[model samples]
Target: MECNKHNQPLSLYCPSHLMPSCDVCISTSHSKCNGITSLASVVEKTKIENSKESVEKDINYFLSILDQLVTSKSKNIKTGENHCIGVKKSINEIRKEINKHLDHLEEKLCQETDIIWNQEKSKATDFISEIEGKRENLKEMKEHLQTVTTNTSKLQSFLGVHKIEQQVHQCQRYIEDLENDERTKEVDIKMKQNDEIENIIGKLVSIESVGEVSVVKTEINLNKETSLRRKAQVKSQEQSNINNMTMNIETKIKINIDKTIRDMICLIDGRFIVVDWHGKVNLLSSDGKLQKQLPIPGDAYSVTQINEDTIAITYPKERAIKIFNMENETVMKVIKLGKLCNGLSFSNNSLAVGLRKEEIRIIDLEGNTLKSIQVQSESYLYNLVYCDKRVIFSDSRGKAVYCVDDSGKQIWQYKQDLMGPEGLCIDTYGNIIVVDFNSQRIMVISKDGQDSKVLISKEEGLVFPQCICFNHNESSGFICDYYGTYLAKFNLSFG
Candidate 1:
């Protein structure tokens, strides 16, 4: 019973109540046994296996989720990396564009800055030049002030010295008066005492000889005082003479007013002549005082003072050139020119006339035509003057001037670049004075044609300069303008 109780053999297990068993246990004991431990073990094992299967399935599911998450994460990482690379590339491109734009902007700024710098530099240069000019002017003013100050100081010193000299002279006079008063008082005392003493001395000298010697010494002293007074008077008189001489010299040095005289032509008799624009020919003294007005048949365009009595004038509107005797006031001869004559000059017994056709016609005083020469383009001749055995004329339309010899040969020609050459005058040095109408200037041309100078342009403020006439000695000249009522005077200094 004890052995059966411990081992429990059992056919008592119902087939329907079979315990769960593993295949290993069934193989180990081929028995239908209700072995709760084995059943529990098998059941526990099945449960463990199911639990393991579930865990494995869960693990597989988790692993698949993990794999999907890892794959998604990897894709996300790759995408992020690609995105980063793209963003970096875009940023680099943007940086490059920005750099290029900045470079272009910098270049444009540099160019503009350079232009601004140049303008500023030019302004600065102009400012500097202006400052320099102002400084020079200031320096000149300072120098002038210094000179004036020096002169003022010198004048003040001279005045002070002069006043001191006057004071000294007054003091000397006072001293002389005092000395004279003392001498006179002493002389009076000597004289008064001498009367009293003479009585005493005469009685004493009759008694003693030494008293007479003292009387003689007193007389010698009186004579010396009288000589000293006379010398003082002579010195005062000499000083007065010197002062009077100085005053006379100062009075003689008087200021003179300079008077300008112009357009003076020397006649044969040492008188002078001038042609006024009012159509009057005035005979003048050498001092420029009007002497007389010569009578003429018409308004004189040109006047030649042949001598003090004989004068020739060209009257273009009257179509006659006339020689008149001033003393008789009569027309001596009249030369008729059919065309309009403008200018006239007398040289070498011949009259040179400038015709409207730009021709210079030479005729004698008796109206015999000697020669004719074309000077410039037709219809351009305006004025003619004789100089150095040549006839000089100006051509307005041709803008030129020409000089021809007495034999009708061209010597020189000046092509003026101005609009018109209207007036002609010849200086003593054989220089030509040309008045240009358009430019309103005076041109000086030498006879050799090698030297030309603009003597007066806008500086003279001339408008429509018409006629120019040179003085006989060529010291000065005169110019007339059609519109300008006043005359212009010019100084001529030729080398």
Candidate 2:
């Protein structure tokens, strides 16, 4: 067999369309098919015996047969065999006593002889009737088998075999039904111990006395311990009240950019690096003053601090990460990413970068890709953070935040009404902070993604906050507004 289009022997199969193809066809026609696997691997996995449908079908057939047989046998079987044996022993003991008492001439004369003879005669008649019914069924089966053997046409013989099989099954079912009938069951009699009388005698003998416990009171010592407990509780209550009270927050403009600032990172020295939509990486002073601006190759989408003096900016459209040194204020290097790089984070001496196709890649300083984690999502990952050996990222289209370990295994995911979740960061308490641009709020979630609450909202004068970053001050964060062009600095509190 050969491929009609390629005019070569079919050596490959395209799983996308389930078509056999030649090597030339595979390279030319089905080059972009991700599901195109080797024909040998497909055959080895999907043979007739090893196929999923075949295995399921065989298992279902066997289970059906076993289920029917078990049901039929259970109907015919007796459950309380041991109980019946005990009952029979008791009945025989009573019979022996009855015989002993009736062995006297006077007792025999007093017995109802007619009634006893009638009962025995009725049981013998019923047994003879059952034997006659079985004999008749056997005779009918023999005649039917002989007629089936003499059938002429093949179709008639096949139908006759099926009919005879059904008849035999029917007969067997009739016999089982007779055996399980109440009238056919063996009778058993038993005399049980008088449990009521035993319980009454047991209650008469026991008289258990459990004494009441009491404590001698000392007024002064008791009062002292109570006062100390009250003081400790009041102190604990004061601390808890402090934790629950909202602080007098202060918001300041830490940085201002003329263009749309997409992301910001706080360096250890109190300076900040902000990347704008116009592909400008700006160095800002601690109090919102633009110190210097460096022009990069493409539109810078995200910026992350790699060290105390270096920051990396991601250009999604250009598929490159430009690393810049803050002390010398120069572009150190640019790593070329083959796919769209949306988010950049530093952890374990590697870059945790998010791609546009919902995947996270770990790359070293030398640009060598270490491992790639597919997020298994339909939405694009816009922002991510590396913390606690977990890559927590936000999917704007999916409207969710996902946490995955280094091996691409999912730890937990939190989904809420997040409209365009863009910037992601982890606070000092390890809580995930996300910026929802449409909702104009900052969402704070626990590390495990279980507890989530709004940290900042539109009521706090945040207008279209796009990016978020934790500050070095520990309890404060920087949020950049896309439309406002100014960063909002606010103190973080739990209440």
How many clashing pairs in candidate 2?
A: 1
Query: Model 1 residue 449 lDDT?
Result: 53
Q: Report the lDDT of model 1 for residue 156.
A: 75
For candidate 1, the lDDT comes to 0.59
Q: Clashing pairs in model 1?
A: none
Lowest summed lDDT over 10 consecutive residues: which window, candidate 2? 206-215
By lDDT, the best candidate is 2
Count the clashes in each prediction. 0, 1
Q: How far is candidate 1 from the true structure (C-alpha RMSD, Å)?
A: 59.1
Question: Per-residue lDDT of 89-197 in model 2, one digit per residue for the tens?
Answer: 8767867885787487446544645456567668867877986987798788788878886836888888887887887888888778877676565644333445544
TM-score of each: 0.42, 0.50
Provide the lDDT at 215 for model 2. 25
